[model samples]
Target: MISKIELLNEIGIALSAEKNSQKVLELILDGAKKLTNADGGSLYTLNDKDELVFEIVSTDSLDIHMGGTTGQSIDFPPLPLHIEGHDNLSMVVTSAVLNDNTINIHDAYHADGFDFSGTRKFDENTGYRTKSLLTIPMKNHKADIIGVLQLINSTSIDTGVVVDFSSEDQKLAESLASQAAVALTNKKLIDEQKALFEAFIKLIATAIDEKSPYTGGHCKRLPELTMMIADACDKDDAGALKDFKMTEKDRYELMIAGWLHDCGKVTTPEYVIDKSTKLETIYDRINTVNARFEVLKRDAKISMLEKQMTARETADEQAFKDAERDYEALIEKLNDDKEFISVANVGGEYMAEDKQERVREIAKYKIDDCEEERCNFFNEDEIQNLTIAKGTLTNEERQVINNHIVVTIKMLDQLPFPKHLENVPEYAGGHHERMDGKGYPKGLTRDQMSWPARMMGIADIFEALTARDRPYKDGKKLSVCLDILGKMRLDNHIDPEIFDVFVREKVYMEYASEFLTPDQIDEVDHSKIPGFSGD
Candidate 1:
């Protein structure tokens, strides 16, 4: 009997430590049955509609088990706590909850003032006798009845004969029910808080994405790709990633980080993020440049007419012919320069030095402004922007764009996260850092970072390379994006092991099939992809 009490204490401790509600329910039912020496038991939880729903059921002698991790469902209808708007005192489980007390019966055939019709029918159908029932109410800290724990057919240990539940047995079951109620309540509260936190995080991400039309679904897509890489790494068992594994909590933390990886982008200016051309802010400045070119063309036409009038006044054929030829040549040169400036305004992958010099020459052409003062055709800022050797952004603008990660770190660090999620800032902030120690913000190296962070780094770059919604360029084909990602692997810009898993597991194709257009999903050659040795 003392050993039974010790076992009951152990069950209470186990109940408090459990995190899963299903496991807690199973533990409660199993512990109650063991303490009472019962052959069968069923745990019922109250639903929103004030009905008792079976959560876990076990009948050892009948070889029956259902619910609570058994993978078998309980098909019995729920018992309503009230019938016709009155308290339900007929059913044993419902009576326990309504009275908020334990109900002990020595035999169902002889028990009075309650309905045993269901039990008798079940027994008749199964060819078993019904006896010895103990039902206890599960009340939380608030003293509210949340569920009921019912045990059936307590047996004498010495003779294995069915008998009534003892006072000690009822007390032990009640104690276990109390512990289980607290555990279940705490678990539900924690889960609700977690759900709310995740929803808020996604809301921030969605707001950031919606801030600019150009960003489209970046925040939404990045996390999907990040998890794909992480999952692939976790599944690998015979390579550099063989030791990589993720628990449910670890996966949840990483997923939260992925959703927030670009939260700092909310601080970035929309014009810079949405800059589609070299001279674009508030509106496209290319139109102003085009207006200047039009003025230059108009001036040339005015000069040509003036020269023709002088040639006609002199009545010289040679002079007239020279004027005509010069006007046509000057107009053609102006048109060509205008066309070149237009092309330069639309940025590309690379701009030649000669083309940049031509922009400078175009800037040298003077035009009369609305202030009646001569101004260069292209302003200094315009010249610098047009002369950019790569994308639309100049050095200063690129720095502004790169400042987001720093801002992300700052933003995430300010939040007071719990212990399980303490690494969210590190995982979210490290995506931009390189494996070679040259990447930005903190400049973390490969050995210094976690695998999930590195996986996010690969995901970030891959999504950027393949995204179809950017204002600057069209999404690249699968082969092209993979080629660039493979090169990034070789350049030490990204984690090599993660990149290998990304390809080996075909994570890219899996993402492409879902998010990319058919045209962008081109055939890829495995051998041609850089830094990948796998077939």
Candidate 2:
């Protein structure tokens, strides 16, 4: 008979490791098989619908493999549980899953005439005789059945001395099953939490999309690409990510940070967020430049006609035709490239009035009626909120865009988190803050931030600079993007020491390897990237 002390010792050993439900099951099955002097075993876990699902102790040798899922809605058939005693093992262990239902069976297989003919694998592989069996139902603290564990052919396992299933065998199997249930339950809870998190992200992204047609789904791609970058970061800096040791609390914090990172976008004005041109609010006024070209054309035509009339007085027709053709060619040249549109505003930085007025005059003839209406149709409150000026936005509009960090802090503050999640608010909020005081919304320097916050800061910026999904910008090639970030490091906008780690780790290249498409990666010159080498 296996002693209680040995069983408890093994249980403590199995549960000490972090996460992954399957390892715990393998431990239970292996431990029970050894304790009961049995040849082989399997663990069956019950799902939400009360359907059984096999966890581990598959058809091969029963060593533990972790992180596998027997989750969702898979079906598991019941084994022909041997009933040898007065008590019902299934009913008792139903408590493992159900939590309140417990059956304390003592001699689980004794008198119910348990059948062996229905058995499969243990005989198929071993080619050995199988006669006796012990079965026990797994129960949680609440007495619900999480799983059923069965030990086949109890005997002198090493010496091949055949023996019948003992009362000891039944007790041991029941104990192991109970432990397996708890592992299964925890795994299920984690899955449910993950699903809820994904749903919440979709909801928030949709709300951001609703604010402007131009940024219809910008926020949604940020988190996806953030995760993809994180994965690359992990691979490139596996040693570094491991140094973080990322506790369960750390994982939860990173998750919240990713979703809430762009909360600042909420405060940014839709027009500024969707601005398609340098001096754009209502009209681009590009047509003004075209109008100036048209006036030039008119002047050219008038001169040519006068010259033609004068020439007729002198009897010369070819010269007037040549002048007409030259004017058309001049207009065509002005039309191409259209003088790379520039506009002047009075609020933040004023554009030169002469240049501004000259462009405005050219646009006069091409101005559509709707263009005027959209220009003047500004909402008093929204305009006040946006702080847009004639030439550029007031300093206030820039602050509003930057206040997305503030919005993130405010929104995350409202979530009621479980214990130790207090840091979630700070970590998520601090993502945009520079290592130096250059970042907005509380420019607390390096010592004030946690390692997790620093990692997040790096992740957020790297994703943004390389990201292609923003309404106003195209994604940069890896070399150009990293060069900018590297310069920022030099400027104290980012951590200089961390930048070294970033280069040595080749974090950007590894990230781009996965994040950038085949054509996208191919477009960049590898050697030019600030921190990467061709070798």
Candidate 3:
């Protein structure tokens, strides 16, 4: 008792709402059979080779269904459009598409001007009579035939007897096919555009990664970790983040943000990023200091020989002995200073006050009469490098490194993102921010930032802490990295709830198993970690 116009309008609405291609195909075929009162239907689309491939098939009398939403694949070969350079118009589906006309046959057994051998074989095998074929070409908005909708064996609604497809049924089927075609075309275009967009994003990430070998793995792994922890949060209903949930669109937005979190690093100089030692600029200046020590040794040797010559003339044995002792003492002092400078060049978590003062004191001594300019034992620049309180980078270099996040925000903000992805800049830019508002750029506190942004913060930090490919320092062990992260959580540097989920889900262990070396993966005591509970 369904009105044909009302049904067609409903089908159009349903088709437009569906986003999945296969689901759209299934819905179209199912709607066509229902509108025509047909017992079975099949949908086919043109493949790359210009052949009609069976995408979905349904038979109500035989209780058979395959392809599309059925979770079954159609194993049938594609129906070729041409045979040996001539149009293969022998088939009803192809003929409809090639001629751009609807083919409505009263009975397949009595139909002429087309081949029904395949239809007869199907009927014979299944003991089902084939009759009343109504085939329509699916034309898109561009007036191009994208696919064909074929319905078979129209039946009387009351008696269940075979019948011809009425003219009214043909009109309804054609209208539904048109709507379905537009829906499918729009979905295909959106899907294709999304694929291209994601690929370009990854390309940018790859370029940034290849810019510096030390951080090559980071650009790829942080998004994955972000997703892992975010997914865990979505599933955990018992935690403080139990209310947190994400849709497919939300997940995609976060993923894009994660990949672009360090995009600003592309603007950073490789020299600053690759600085492995404190005294390193173009090269480590420790070698320059080592050369100075050699000059001092040479000077001591010459002074000793001169004193020996003077002592021999005067027969001053005690003075000669005294000169020899003085020369040895000077050489010993030079060796100690060289060792200290070499150690300082390596850089560490801390450089003691005395060590820094000693660097200043050493800078006062000039290397006299060298091949190059008479420079200090350590030049001004070298002294500044050696006296760095921590790590290899100076204050200026750290600022340059930190500015990448600022650049990332600026770059992402300029893009014309749609409504769903409008927060990409905020999410990516906020990863460097701390929960206590101590982070850079915007300095957003825990509540100011979104959940996904906070999750990305943990991801960025954990990846850096455990990354094995960094040029400056060795990747820390799992226990060590987790210990540091746990302390950070207590210190309000990271979100406590997210960190707890990260620990409870063992996401770190999963990442380590895949990306970390065997030695870096070690047993961890969750209870011992600060701000962490075994829950």
RMSD values for the candidates in order, in angstroms, are 2.5, 8.1, 2.3
> TM-score for every candidate vs. truth?
0.92, 0.66, 0.93
Give the better candidate number (2 or 3) by lDDT: 3
Q: Report how far residue 91 has shifted in candidate 3, in Å.
A: 2.4
The top-ranked prediction according to TM-score is: 3
Write down the TM-score for model 1.
Answer: 0.92
Write the residue-wise lDDT of candidate 3 on 92-149 in tens digits: 9989988899999998888888999998999899998988899999999999999999
Model 3 misses residue 234 by how many Å? 1.1
Q: Output the lDDT of residue 166, model 1.
A: 99
In model 3, the Cα lDDT at residue 458 comes to 97
lDDT of 2 by residue, 1-535 (tens): 4365587567746754536566566677777777777766556666655555666543223332322353433244543223353222343233233333223222334424322333435356556544565556676667666577756666665587657666656665665666666666666677688678768866776777678665565566445544444444454443444454455565655666667667657667787666554445566433543464565566567877787788778776777677677767766754542552322222222344565444444343332233343232222332332233332444655666677788888888898866656787787788778877767688878778866566667766777666665544567766667777767766677655455556655666677776765544544443554543333
lDDT of 2 at 36: 71
Question: For candidate 1, lDDT tens digit of each residue in 71-143?
Answer: 9999999999999999999988898888888999999999999999988999999988889999999999999
Cα RMSD for candidate 2? 8.1
Candidates' C-alpha lDDT = 0.91, 0.58, 0.90
Clashing pairs in 1: none
